[model samples]
Target: MEEERLSQQLHEYALWKADVARNLGLYQNFLESQDNEDNELILRIEDIIESLSTDRIVIAFVAEFSRGKTELINAIFFADYKRRLLPSDVGRTTMCPTELLYDHVSKESYIRLLPIETRLEDTSIAEHKRNLDYWTTLPLQVESPDKMVEAFKEVVKVKRVSLEEAKRLGLFIEDMAQHLEQVPEYVEVPMWRHALISFPHPLLKGGLVILDTPGLNALGTEPELTVDMLPNAHAVIFVLGADTGVTKTDMDMWQEHVKVFSSGGKKGLLVALNKIDTMWDELENSETVASKIKGQCVSTAKTLGIDVATVFPISAHKGLLGKVKHEAALLERSGLPKLERVLSDEILPQKQRIVRDRVINGIGATIKMSRDSVKRNYDGTRQQLDELQSLDVKNNSMIAHLLQMTRKETIIYETRVENFQTSRALLMKHVKEMQEFLNITELDKHITAIRKQMEGSWTTGGMKKGMTQFFEQIRYNMTQVSYTASKANESMQSIYKRFHEDFGLVDIKPSILSMHHYDMRMDNLAKRAEEYRDSTAMTVSEQSFVIKKFFISIVSHARDIFAKAFQEVENWSKSSLVPIAVQLKDSKTALQRRIDNLQRIRDSKETVEGRIDELNQSLADFEARLKQLNEVCDAIHKPLSFDQPPAEAEDIKQQTAS
Candidate 1:
């Protein structure tokens, strides 16, 4: 029943995304029909449509070894097979970080594995994903569940390697070695570093992605998982063992990795207390067992410094069994239904809200500008028609007088155009200055210099100092960019105001370039760097490995932030002066047309009634085009139905306790 609910919700989400894309396509068509010259706006809309078409909702499962994380995933997503799909039993099943998704482009089912030896290189997992040569591929026969299971077992494969090789891979630590009974010549390690499984499941085809991660050791060795993949997931489920009730290693993983999401008020950070059947006793009554589980839930929540409402107690083992056997009572006793409901209720709506916000912020202003332009043209055409109808055709002197007045008006408009060009040149100078502050090439040079300094350092203190200086320099550069953006915004506003005062053009507010978000991101990166410098993991890892991981994870993230800022500035430069420029050109063309009509009438070459008939036809065309523009704007802003009924409080209390 819970699986059905999740699948239905995913289906609905996919439909909502399609609806949005269809409307955007209509808007694109409208622009092309009107011969809209704002190519940047059209390109942005196309990008948004492409993003909606290929977007994936990622959910990451995080846990230490023997925590039932894999079993829970099987119970929730793979129960339609009526059996366990992935290799999940006893001590350690998923030896590497595995990603389960559908390959829509290829439309094929397969498993791709990256060799553990890739850790010796400086390339990140994300980079390795783009190159097919680095991974081994195997075909998946979805028709037979047994064959699929046999192929999936390869994710759990391991090999024994020399101690030196293990240490070089950053998989062996002194703290773990001290727990061994005696020094060994070899250590056991996973053969694969990462796994990618593309299957044709209903939910996967609907854009659902599952990331099943390994224990703390693997997470520590692969810095990219902690720094990029997990943080970017739409939701994170941190699983814990009910019998052990949050061990030391579990607490370490929570504090180092998962706590950041919850502390920052990010939604969809859920705690699944798995293996609850261990607490079920036949000697005691059901009520007594329930009370004990409730106490454990309260205790775990307090220890973790999280809300008890966010903690879910469930038995993944029994859930899977009951699902396969088709027993409703057993599935209800497992307490898996409630967790699934909350996940579906929370994640889908949140994802929709994010997409909606992006659409509104990205192209909402451009649509409005297009509508305004259409209305202005319609109004101007009507005024010209009224003026021509009010004229007397038999009086040549009157026509001659009107022609002289129009010629003088044309000259005045020409003077204004010259002034506009001068102001535009000044605005371009300020734009150039802003671009210099955000140049990506200049930022890369700074990064290269800092990396070299850290590489040459002989002591840990020197390396730490180098990292601190790197952030300080980045912050300084950001401050300069922020100041320049403010100055440019002020200049743009002044230009718009002058046009409104001089001519009758509407006073449109130009787009402002805000740097608050980028500033906050840089500050967060600095905090992460500070924490890494003081971490025990850094102290135990080799010096070379430490430098490489720091640059790959932390520095690379900072570079991404700067690159986005640079792109935004470039977009602002293109779009800031568009509305006024378009209006000026339209007004100039209308004046020239009016002057030509009066000149023809004064020369006795055309009748006044004939000119009037042509103006009336042109006015009708403008009205039709204006109506079409309004309809396109309305479609783009239409609201989607993303409402989901809230779960009852009584249901939450029972499920949280169970």
Candidate 2:
């Protein structure tokens, strides 16, 4: 039952996300009703809502071959099927990296596989995903476990190819060839490079994604897996064999692929010492067996150089069998419940915090600005109503003087608008300068040059030097961009302060462009490059393979960093002045409306009583909208509760079955 906690937390997280999306929709509708012309704000809200709708919490399972990574996935997520959903028997069952997620967009269950031959192309896997023609598709019959199993067999399929072809695909290694007494003309390689399975499992439908990766060879050849996918996962479960403890290949995978994530305080990195049943001796007592498992876990932690608490000893084999047979005691003995509890308790809350922070920072600030604008308009209207009500129509001199005063106020507002336009021009100039520093086209030029240099190099050392210089140039560019961003921020702050002092305007601090994270990301990538350069494994590998991996993993990631910085700069440029502009426009419109009403009163064309009545109705409308806006804000800020008891796993299974 404790294993159900992960499912329960995922359910609650889904509900919470829906609630936030609903509130965002309400806010978007409110904005549309109030000001249809503020399309920028409306579009921003739409983007946030779209992201919430499609977001997935990705958990990647990484390990060397025969580590039970796939078996663990089947036990934890697919136990309700009463059988193995993924191929997990014997050696090298899953030859390629596989992804399991619900197809929220298509609402169809299917398996998509990318042919291994596509690796010969320059296009990345991410690019291939966008164009379905590159992948072979198969319909998945989720209702029939046997059919699903048969379809999943394609992931483990392999084909014999000439050794030359395998080498060209970057699948051949000299070390692997050296193992043979005689050089073979042909070698077997995975038929597919990647597998994506979309089915309507409850957890998958609740926005959970499971990434099952193959061994080190696959990780080394497929650079995107290490550079992009693993790093982006919400949590990474590195499965280790309890029978072998931490092997050399496992340690290599950890240090080269997974250890960098640990530097971020190891919050989302977890170790699963799988196949603990290997140490389950019939002659030993339960306490003795558990002690051995615990000792192995500690040893694994020591070898991996991580805290022992992060290492969990589990038997994926028994866990799957227990769940299928409905034997709770067997499952308990498998040590799955404790691991599940920690995963649910730690990962879900951390994910929630990340989503909460993004929503608060993005939509929350915009809503506050909108509310302030509405409040200002309401207050200004009330003041105008009070002033109008004080006037006596019989006193023509008083009405004339009031009309003159309002016209003068209109002139002052017009003057302020002109001054704001000049200041805006200066701001735009600074924004242009900032944009120059973040120009993607310029970054592309740098990338092109670096690629040429690396390609022209004859030796591994020369290419490694080129790789180092590539990152150095990128780092230098980011530093320049950061400096320019700071300058632009200063100009924006000055503009806000001037308006606040000269005319009564709200002093809204502009959104800062923080490049520190990107800077740190580049630094990490550089560090990874250095490690790769110094790697004995890479030294033994082909120079061509090394170059391809460097570009795919390191250079591509650096390019992405620059792209994101460019996008952020553009967004900041557009939104930084929106609030003040909205307020000023509303103020000017209010002033004009007052002048028109008072002039009519002075000309004896419209009654003072009539004008007062109109003002009263307008005031009431603003108040009602303001109240609704406040309620929407409250809904957006409301915290989600996760203390409710979880439903039994059997109940969840039945519901999904239905």
Candidate 3:
């Protein structure tokens, strides 16, 4: 909900910024007024928001000249995969970024390559299917976002190959040998630089996202995709070298930017502190090194005006299994869930807040404008002006009604954003804490206990009996663990719901503000009609002389009376508060009619967040319980090698008592 909201705000602000820029250009030519930097800053905020919204992460194995970017990607995303998105080597591996999306159906699956020069009107594709010679070098193109996949299939993947054998598919023995054995240079091939690659993955439901970006030379020399695709992805895992934290080039990339014109706004930005294993190897004290690395990340986040929670430390290369820690007993996969949760929960909610803020700001602007206009109308009454100026700066008074509204609205806007941010921060912090609490250290302790128990069980029960009992205990534990997971999941949903409601989310009763406003409007309209009827009705041909000559005068009198009435009310109320009060009252009535239409935006956001939180908790508990349930099943059915029946019973007793 928050992410959707932030995206909405960023988009709105982005559009507003673009419109402002367009107007600025026109005004420069026609009005010849000097441009205000302050105004430009406001517009830039919107533009920044837009940039954030459109960002699809493209992490170019960015390094100086050649620092093994392609090698890293190949190792990370494609080592186990059946198909290679792009042929990689020590040099010139990726001439183009092979963007991989998912395409479920499309019998004749083929590769589509789109050149950078391909226009919106041009619908062309360079396709190859099963033919290894042609498959590796096809150009892809598409006319619109609508046919992006079709273009990808036509240009990147082989079409209608039907899982043909290597020999039948005419796979070159030499090419296959070259592919298996690393060479100095990647195979020379024609590239559709702008083309995207779409194919199916065996494991993941959404399929795998493998972005084969071009060499640093092309990316730096002509930075198009970098700008275009950064904000598009759910998260960008910027793979920097652990050996070098922030080189001159890295700092430059962070600092120097193109003066790109934005029509939208910027919102979500995340940083990835990658390649920690290299630092771990370099520094003798790995703990000290890791601490320093985390500190550096915090410092970097500060420099970039982003949250540290947005930063992720991922050993993508290590996770790919190219390098495994000998000392480690189990797989260390810390960054995956961190990245997923950051994108899905934290980043998502921030985007939503940005959207809500935009709406509130827009309303505030209207209120401020109305109040400002009213003040200007009655500007220089020395006594009145002096009296009006003497009120609390933060009060909900007419003296600063519009300004106060602006601030109040900003508070309301920030409230949700702040809550989401806080929730995200707390959520991530606790999850990480959970991981740390049940880390390798915890596992090691359990393994140690199990080892001791196993020896005792072997001494007591015969090998056959011990083994059977252990298996039975494992099964019993698993069942109990599953039960615990189910219970925790149920509890979490209620907890998340309470958090959501605390932030002003409650029953779905209709808004009374708008209905009251409508009633007020009807009453006024009826009174006016009755007054008109009491006066006189005359034909156009025989109109009353008084009516004909005094219509404008009558309106003027009524308006003047109303104004005076407001002025008279100023002793108790406020002089500037009239307009905002009118707007609120009017808006209230309109809002009641379309209250549902007013967008329960915050409500929508909280709902998604609450649900996600509940699911995540359930998943965590489910993981823990499954482990226990397996142990229980093993205890009941068969003897286990890991622990004796007494040990299993001890654990189960403690759990059941809790």
Better lDDT candidate (2, 3): 2
Number of the candidate with higher TM-score, 1 or 3: 1
What is the Cα-based lDDT of residue 392 in candidate 2?
75
Can you write out model 2's per-residue Cα lDDT over 1-658, one digit (the tens) per residue? 7657788778777877877788889888887886456787788889888888888999999988889999999998889889998999777778888999999888899999999988877878887888999899999998899999999998899999998898887777888768889988998889998999999988899899999998756667776887789878989999999888788888887888888777756578999999998999999998988887888888788888889998988999999999999999989989888888877888887887788778988878788888887898899889988888777778888878877887888888888878878887887786677667667788788878877887788577778777877877777778887888787888788778878876766667778867788888888778767765666555234657656665766766777887888777777777878877787888888878877877888788888788889889989988987997887788677554432245554453343234
Off by over 4 Å in 3: 1-92, 104-108, 115-191, 202-211, 220-223, 231-234, 257-267, 282-286, 298-307, 322-337, 347-658
- In model 2, the number of clashes is 0
Q: Per-residue error at 490 for model 1, in Å?
A: 1.7
**Tens-digit lDDT string for candidate 3 (1-658):** 2223333333333343343334323322221231222343244335534543433323333433233455455444444442222453444445555666444444223355554322111121221222233234333332233343334333322222221222221221232345565532323222344444554433111233445555343333222333334423433444445456656555544443211111133434445565666666453676786687788778766755566776666654554443224212111432433544554445444543443444333233322333333233223122222332353323434424444444565456455455544544443443343233223344345434544454454332332233234334433433343343334333333434444464333222211111222223223322332332232221111122212222222222223333332222221122122233333333333223222211222234323334334435544543543443333223223221112367784564343333
Q: lDDT score, residue 45, model 1?
A: 87
lDDT of 1 at 496: 83
Model 2: how large is the Cα RMSD against the reference? 3.6
Cα error of candidate 3 at position 404, Å: 53
Error of 1 at 345 (Å): 1.7
Stretches of candidate 1 exceeding 4 Å from the true structure:
34-36, 537-544, 603-624, 643-658
lDDT of 2: 0.82
**Maximum-TM-score candidate:** 2
